[model samples]
Each structure stands twice: as C-alpha cells, then as structure tokens.
Target chain A: MTRTRKPGISRRSTLALMGAGAVTFAAPWVARAQVKTIKIGMPTILSGRVAQLGTSSRNAVMLEVEKVNAAGGLAGRQIEMVIRDSKGQPQEAARIARELVNTDGCEMLLDGEASSGSFAVHEVARDLGVLCIHTCSEASSLTADPKQHIPNAFRCVRQGIHDSIVGASYAAGIAKTKGLKKWATCSPDYAYGRDTTGEFVLYLKKFAPDVEIISESWPKLFQPDYTEVVTKILQAKPQALYSCLWGGDLTSYIDQANIYAMFTQMEVFAVNMADYTALTVVKNLPKGIHSGDRYIKTFPPTPENAAWGDAYKAKYNEYPTNWSWQNATAVMFLNEAVKKANSTDGKKVAEALTGLTIKCPFGADGTVTMRADDHTLVGYAIGWGTTIPQEPYVPDVKAGDWKTIFELEAEWKKSKGYT
Target chain B: MDLDALASCLASPACLVTQTTSGLIIGMLLFLVAVGLTLIFGVLKVVNFSHGAFYMFGAYFAMTAYQLTGSFALAILAGAAGTAILGLIFERVFMSRVYGRDVLMQLLVCYAFVLIFDDVVRMIWGPEFKSMGMPAAFQVPPLFIAGGVVPPYYLLLIGVALAAAVVLGLGLARSRIGKVIRAAAQNPGMVSALGINTGLIYGGVFALGGMLAGLAGALAAPVRSLTPGMGFSVLIESFIVTVIGGMGSILGALIGALLIGLIRSFGSLGFPLFTEGLMYLFMVIVLVSRPTGLFGKEVA
Candidate 1:
C-alpha cells in the first residue's frame, strides 16, 4: 500500500537520481584529489626536559607554513605538517620518522630532533629516501662527515663547527684581554656536547695558546644536579669556563652555579646561553658572562631581524629561541626549494636545495647559503657577546665573519677525513 | 683505577669538603622525594608510578603560588597542600579500586595518571621551561665553608630537609597515627578487623607521602628549572633509592638516598663520564647482594 501511495520515480529516473547523489557525494573527493598538498613530517622531542626545543621549532615552522599558505602556497599547493613527538628517544624518533613517511603519506621530512634523535632520523630519511631538512641538530658530523651524508638530507641549522670557530675566535679575544688563562669546561655528555666542546677548545687553544683546560666535567644531558660539576670547577680554580649546555640545562646550570658564586669566581662562556630561554629564565643573571648569540632580536642588528623577532613574540607571546629561528629558516628554505623545483618530488626538491641561498632575517649578511659541498647552512648571524641584566641581553653585538667560519670548517673537515 | 684522576679529585681538601656537603644537601632533597614513595609502597602495597608526576605538579603549583604571593614559605605550603589534595583524590577515586587487583593492574592505573598529569601540566603551563625565581632571602652571597664557596641556599636546603626527616622519623615512631600506619602496613586486614578505617588510613598515608614529594619539589623549584617531565629524572633516582634502601623501609630510604647522592657527587669528580651509569651500577650491586634492600625485611 505504501508503494502504491508513494510518489516513486520510474526505474530510469531512480537510476539517474542515484547517479546524481553519488556524483554529489564524490564531488568533494574529486576536488580534494585535484588540490594537492605537500605533507612534511616532523619528528622532534616534544616532551621531557628540552620540550621547548620542539615547541619553538614547531611554532616557527607553522608560522612559516602559514605565511606560505597565506601567500597562495608553493606552486598553488598548500603545505601541511605532520608532527610527531619522539620524547627525546632515538628509537622513537626513527619509528615516528618511518611511520610518517610510510603510514602518514608524508613526502618530506623536517628533522627537528637534537643530535641523538637527529642521527636516528637521518638514517630513517636515508632508508625512506625522503628529502629531509634538519632544522635543530647542531652536531657537526650530521652533515660534515662524508660517511653519514645523504643526498636527500641537508642541514639548515648552524653546525657546531661553525659556531665553535666563531665562538672561540670571539672568546679568545676576551680571554686574552681579560688574561683568562686557566680554563675549565662543564658540557653535557653527548655527541653535540662533546664534539662542540672539543671543537671550541681546539680553536680556542689555537687562537689563545696560553689557555689551559685544567678541569673537564661531562655531565649527562639533562642531568638534574650540577653541584658536583660546580665543585669540580671551583677545585680547579679556572679563571674561565666553557659549556655547550643549551635550553633548560643551561638555565639550570647558571642558576646552580650562581648559588656558589661560580660566575663571580670565573668568567663563563656558555655558547648556548645568549638565547632568551636561558637569559630571561636565569634569576639574577650575572652580567658580563660571555655567550654566543643563540637568538637575540638585537644580535643580527637588522631591521628585518628585529621585525621578525617582534612578530614571533607577538604571535607566540614568548621570545623565540635559536631553535625557532633555525626552524623558520628550514621552512623558508623548503618553500623556496619547492618553488624552484616546481614539484614536490623529493629528488627534484633536494637537487633544488643544493647551494640554495635565501635572503632571510636571521642571516649574517642578509643572506644564508646552503654550502654546496657539505650541504650545511653557512650563514645566519654566528657571534658572541657579553650578557646584560635587561632586554637586548647581549648588547653591542659582535657578528661573526662567515668567510673565516667556512675556511676553518673546511680545514676541520679535512683533518677529520670528512672532506 | 686511574690514580692520577683520583689524586686530582682529592688534591683539594676544600673541594672534597664542599662536595661532601653538597652530597648531603642532595641526599636530603632526594630523601624528601623517596621517603614518600617508599611510604606509599610500604603502606598501600602498590607501586606509585605517578609519584614523579606528583613531584612535577608540586613544582608547578609552588611556582604559581610564588607568583601569586611572592613568599617562598607560602609556596612550599601551597605545593605540599596541592599535591596532597591531588594524591588523596587519586587514591580515593582510582587507586582504591585497584587495591586488591593484580600488580599489573595497579601499575597500569598509576602509569595512566603519570601520562595524564604530564599532559595536564603541558596544557596549563605550555611546553616551555619555567623558572621560579629564588627568594631574596636565599640570594645572599656564597658562604665560605672549608675554603670552598657554598650557596646559602644549599645550607637552607640541608637544614629544611633534615628537619623534615627528623619530624617524619619521630612522627612515624612516636605518634598514634604513626603506630596505626605501621600496624596497617604490616597487616591491613588485621587493622580493618580491629575496627580501624583502613581506607581512610591508606588515603592519609598516600596524601602524606605526596606532601613530602611536593615539599621536595617546592624546595627544588627555586634551584632547578621547571618542565612538564621534570619529575621523571627525580622519580628514576627515587626508584633507585627505594630499591637500594628496601622498598618499604624509611631508614633504608635515607641511607640509600645519601649513598646515591654521595656517589653521584663523588662520581662526577672522579668518573664524570660514567657518573650516570655509576648509579645504575650501584643499584645492580645492591639488587644482586641484597634483594630485600639495606633495611627491607623479607615479606612472607
């Protein structure tokens, strides 16, 4: 009775209606298939003591990606990031990297890990054959060592060797002026810490031969207590100290060292301390401590740099760290490469990235070059300065010369058989 | 067996003295964290895996309190009270159901809380390091002890921690509630049969343990930077302390914490590269030699 009463369509009409309904349902899928988006997977430490490293990196990347999208994206294709937390574990980083490429359909990889996790991601990128831009790791060998080099993986962040040469040159001058002959080192015990500290010391000794490292303490990365290290330094009675501890570790080290008047006794030259993360967090930040400019708005002393820093702070409500700038540079480089290649193919984009020079705010001379040989970033305001108690923490910024950095880096690579 | 290294570390008598003092300060702070963990395990017969999360919360809570009131003492109180309240709620709501369950079930519940607490902290504070500025009183110049410079705050930490230990030791030994807690730990069924509210006793003990951990966190806040997973390192150290001290023994916790602290400080001086491994090595030695721990009794 319902069939008789219902105003049912004829068989042909019903078929046409079903076809129309199917087309309507499939229309968005058709549009979605046509509008392609480039998916870049980021595996970074998003938890643990150095979670800020990941947070800032992700923030900067998102900011750049947002800009690219707002500017109509790369070749009219939107950029999407699939970010994963490695919890600072190397195996987890590898797993997430693989999963992002294999399972999540990510075409490119943005390795946001520190040294340990970054190595793992490097291998994964190699195995997966995805274009990977390392944005956070500063460990020299990740790019400098020919053995570990992958054609698809390039580092956009400052390398430890570059920073060491610049930092040592700057610190050597200060040490000579201050007559700081005796030296002690308290660096985190890891590849980045050990390698960077060693490189800095090597250069420092070369530049200032009178400097003697009487004491060396290699505290495990993220070691909560620094009492023993401080005591060791005091026992040595070094006139100066050098450390590669960054982020919260540096902040904690400074705070604990201050408690024992370590700063008063010895001039500290922590390469990672000039960043706002440590400077702003350090309570009663003792003035006159030397530090490599990690990421101060005023360090590059460029209007563009200051404007970018201001924009980041205004957007995130926090000062950007070295990681923020490095990741921003990475996304910028990636965007440029995509545009230059005119395709999202990993090989093509990677080829395009070779020796790519991008004019960005963080650069030393208004430009940073991706060194053709090592595939590592060559510029981006590498320098050291003394700390002040207030904003523009490291005033009278002294920028490093990239030419000298590159020359020394090449020598270093040759010595290490990495040329 | 590098004599040169040993000699180098021992060359400075003042440094040795300062290291010893620093070890004691570290030990006392660890005792504050471990004592609560051991107490909870001993009384509840459940490993409180979320203890570290509790410690993290304590630090964050103390930071907030310090920001609001600008009083260090009040910050410590706020941290302790906040964590205590959190522990009580966790015990009454979640832990109570898993009391007689399998150990795996109990661990799962506690571990879930750890993850939840970590995420909650990140959500509230954001994933960035936070510093609780040292109070003005503790900012005095370094104190010279045995020709070595020591922070005035280090002495204060030692003093407060020792006071806490003495009060806790006496409370557990002499007070009526302490007697009941000891009795309940030994035989909760018997305590229940004797008309004692075992549930209330368990909750109170858990809360008290959390309070101690919170106290440690609050005290440490001024010295160490705060992170969402900051408690993890402390938690691992506490576990090592508990394992070496015997999981259920208060006195054992004290000795174990001191041993670890001293080892860490001394290890850093002599074998800086292996300092972290040294702790685990010590734990292994302890476990192999004395499974029940330094003061632990064999549970029948």
Candidate 2:
C-alpha cells in the first residue's frame, strides 16, 4: 500500500512535485516579506451562542483600525487587526491565540471579552510575551495572583468584585429610598456568578448593616427556565432584587418574569451587566419599566459617542451597543499606547500604559485612566436603565422609555478604608 | 431613609430593572427551543439531538429569507416553513432508518448530524455573527404595566407562546389527526395493523417538532439576537427540560419550563451565589428519584 507503483506515483507525482517545487523556488521571495503593517490579534467569541458580542466587538475593533490607518497610519505604518473567533470556548481560544502569534505574528492581543476565553488566552500571551490589553473580560483572577497563571495579562474593564460592589450598592440605595430594608439576589451558578453575588452580599451588608438578605437563589447558567426561580424570589418578598446574570441569561430571566408579572412585583431589580448587553439584545424592553432610568437611551448622544454611533448605525442599521462601544474604546486605548511607545514591544507598551490616559468615545467621564496597580482602568463605568422617554426620535413613546439615568459615577475609587 | 441613600437609589434604577428583564427574556427563548425537544422525546421515545441543529438552521434560514425580502414577517415564515421541510426530510431520509434501533445508535446518528449541520452553517455563513432586526410593528415601547416601562415586544412573545400552547393542546385533544398521531405514538405496530401509515405519521410529528423549533428560532432572533452557535445554548437547556418533563410529554415540558423559569428568576435573587447550579440540582433530583420527570408517567 505504501509503494504499490513507483512509476505511477512518479507520473502522478509530477503535479505534486511541481506544486512543492514552485513554492520552494519562491521561498526567497517569501523570505523578503517586509513589515508593512503591525499585526494585532483580537480573539473574540465570534461564531457561537455569544456570536453577536464577538462580532460587534470585532466590528468595533475593525472600525478603530480603519480610523487609525486612515489618520496617517500608526507610526508611519498601517495597523492591521487579525481577528479570530474563540467561539466562546477556552480551548479554541488558546489554540487560536497560539496561531495568531505563530502564524500571524501579532504583536499585541486585544479583546478576549468572555471570561473563559480571556483566561485561556492569558496563558498563551504569557508564554508568547505578548501584550494583551483586555477591553471587556473582568474575571478578577486575570489581574490578580500571578501564581495562578499569568501576572503579565492585564484587563481594561472593571473586575467581578467591582461590579458586585456597584450593583449591590445600587440595590441597597433603592431599598433605602423606598424606606425598605430587605434585599435578595438571583445569579447564575458559576464562578463569576458566585463570586459576584458573594461580594455583593458582603458589600451590601457592609454598607446597609441593617438591611437583611431575605433569600438567595442560584440557577444554573444557561438553564432553559426561570419560572421556578421567579416563584421562590417572589415568595421571599425582598424589597430589592440583585442579579449577576449577564448576556443570554439576563434575557431569559426577563422573559420568564414578564409571564408571572415578576417585574411588577419586585420593588427594585439590579443587574450588573443589564444595560450592557441584555438591554441591547432585548432592545425596547418595556421602557419606563427599567428601574434606574440611567444608561438605556439611544439619544441625547455625546460628541465622543456621536461619530462611532453614527458610523455603527449606518453600517449595521442598529444602535451602537455596550460591548461594541467598549471594544472600540479598548482598541483606541491600545493604539494610543502603541503610538506613545513607538514600538510593538509588549513590555515597553505596558510601561507606557502605566499612568497613561486616553479619552474614550464610550466613556461618560471624559477619559479612561489605566491604573498602574493591576492595569485595570479607573475611569467612568456607565450604567443605564429604562425611563419615561422624551426623545423625539422614538415614536409611540410611552410614559416610561429607556433613558440615561446615571452618567460618570465615581464607583471604583480605591479605598483607604479597606485595610 | 437617608437623603444620601435616596439619592443613590434614584441614581441607579437602570441596574435594578435591566437585571429582571434580562432574566425573563432568557427564559422565554429557552421555552421555544426546549418545548419541542420535550414533545419529540415524550412520544417518540428518542431524544431529538438534531433539534438544536434545526434551530440553528431556522435562524440561518430566517437570515436568508430576511436577506431575500427585507421583512421580518417573511423571514419568520420562511424560517418555520424551511425548518418544517427540513424536518420532513430528516424523518423520511434519515430518521426512518433508525426506528427500533438502540437508543445509543439513535443518539450517535443525531450527534453526527449536529457536526454536519454546524459545519454547513460555518461554510455558508463564513463564521460571522449577523443580527436580525425586529419588525417595525413589533418595536413598540412598553405598555403601561402598573406604571413601569416594559418592551411591548416581550408581551408579544408571551402571547405567542401561550397561544401556541393553547392551540397545540386543543388540536392534540380534539383533532382526528391528533388522535391518530397519539395512537401511533402509543402503539406503532397496532396503528400499522389498523392500516395507518406509521411512517408518514412519524414524519409529520417530526416535521411538527421542526416547525416548533423554527418558530422558536424566529421568535428568539429578536430577543436572543442572531449568531452562529445560538442554537446550542437552546439545545442544552431544552434537553434538561425534556428530561425533567418526561421524555415525551408536552404538559411536562410546560410545567418543567415554568419550573425552570422561576428557578432561574429566584436563583438570581435567592441563591444568587450558586445561581448556575440550580438547574443541575433540579435535574439531579428529578433523575435520581423518578428518572422520568415531574409530569413523566414512565421512566424509559
């Protein structure tokens, strides 16, 4: 079987021989490859259940690349973004991260937005000595405790603990305003879910002191139903509700709640990433129904957000969403960092990023400050909700429509009291 | 209440409401994908592994239809019809050959279809995530529900699901064809002896299952948003629902859906820390004792 007919192989082998011979003869030309553009790798969840997020992120990054290249290029050379879909799987993320470095020769890695994907790529970046400026995934572990994995990996978004602190405090504040002192939580049953919930409970307890946790329910992530969970929450009769569920889980929760009128029953509902992705997916969710009335509106656009938002709308025929905006801002910051460093060296860029700040189009606080401590951003974290809309752009405007209720809140200040 | 606390509460109401709404939407999408799996397993005596693939195809089909005709309605109709056709083809060309085969073989074949279907999507869609817009008619703002903002589309979703349940239930209970399908489900050999075309009935049932999945994909596109692997998430949860509701029971699917839905909602609030474990916990409990489900009459 290995050598049935050498003559037949040689006759048919001429084509194969020619194929290899041609490539081999062209080897000198391939070796003359010049550095026309700096390649940056962005492995996102492009084609899976969370494919929308990844796609939106990639589009945002690509838009940044286009803007950068158009504006005299970066350092007299065009910046090229090599995007690979993680498919929201860690194994695939690791594999693709390696390929991006080995095959594509990407200097910097931007945006592995999902927690698992980011964690997977972090290890590969450490081995490759590649600078990974994360715009989204904030699993906490990625930034802290080098013993666990890569201490070199840095995230641009707020961590899991920060989210819990913000979400819980908001819920407690609602309870206080309503003269109620009870709180409950519903979160997905996973590491991110559990950690966020636990941290929220701790912080809420620390702040309120008097408010009680009436009940707690942990449903499995991506579980088909939320009805049973809803019943248990209503039975607890908490004054306010807290949820760490993001993405599709948030959408599922809202659908089930509408059926049982749970939305009407709860005094307050606090979702960590609610206005971020969930609101985008379930756009125009009963307007005034949003609890905060903060970051939900698609109008009254800021100057910074105007250009990107307009461009996104023109291309996708939809509003620019949270993940998309975050990703764009992340790439912009990364490009600025590279420009300031004037080199693609990972360590030099990391050094340049320390104490360096850039204004982001998506930020409400005018600028995003990259903290030197863990390389996490210290700038604005915007949260929005549904409100009574006054925007003329939207029609059939009910009494309650989504609006930007909160803007540029100082929620992530490093505390002197933590010790 | 302190003035500072009041101010903070007023400042961040969006966080409170978005969480609640997000959970609700997720549950609704799960029902669409899972209910069909429950039905196929309930009477067919085999887990429909290809259900997710059908769902993935439905979303893709909707995308194709939407591209052809820039109308959400046309896309939805095309999605349903195309999936139903695919289901018919699936039953006639592939599934018909597997009846009475070992459950393992049935599962393996279905699993293989998943690989094939996923690759097909990748080849066609080119590994890109595409979003489908909601119809202008359905983009209405939240109706006044006790002085709260709610997206009117959500109400439409609930209405559609409830109406489907009612129509399906009534048809199954009253229609002559329904009786025949039920009889065929109960005793295929006996129905065949009575001169019924069991093969055709099975194909029709599978097609009906496919239609449900396709409808689910259409309804979900607006809420879940479109992407390549969107169906897999639906598939996993639906499997849990089918297992919990008893393999082949529609009522079980409904009850199980509500159970899972509420569990998810409460889990976000109650045991928020372990919210991800609630469904698996329920699954373990159901499988350990009854092994059929809450509404399941028999354990396979």
Which candidate wins on TM-score? Answer: 1
Which lDDT tens digits does candidate 1 get at residues A170-280? Answer: 999988998999999989877678888898999999999999988898887777778878877787789999998877888888788888888888889988888888888
Give model 2's clash tally.
87
lDDT of 2 at B120: 82
Worst 10 residues of 1 chain A by lDDT: A1-10
Q: Which candidate is the best by lDDT?
A: 1
Cα-based lDDT at residue A298, candidate 2? 40
* Docking outcome class, model 1: medium
User: In angstroms, what RMSD does candidate 1 have relative to the true structure?
Assistant: 4.8
Q: TM per model?
A: 0.90, 0.68
For model 1, the superposed segments whose C-alpha errors exceed 4 Å read: A1-41, A86-107, A120-130, A149-151, A335-349, B1-13, B280-291, B298-300
DockQ of 1: 0.52
Chain A TM-score from candidate 1: 0.90
Candidate 2, chain A: TM-score against the reference? 0.79
C-alpha lDDT of residue B113 in model 2: 90
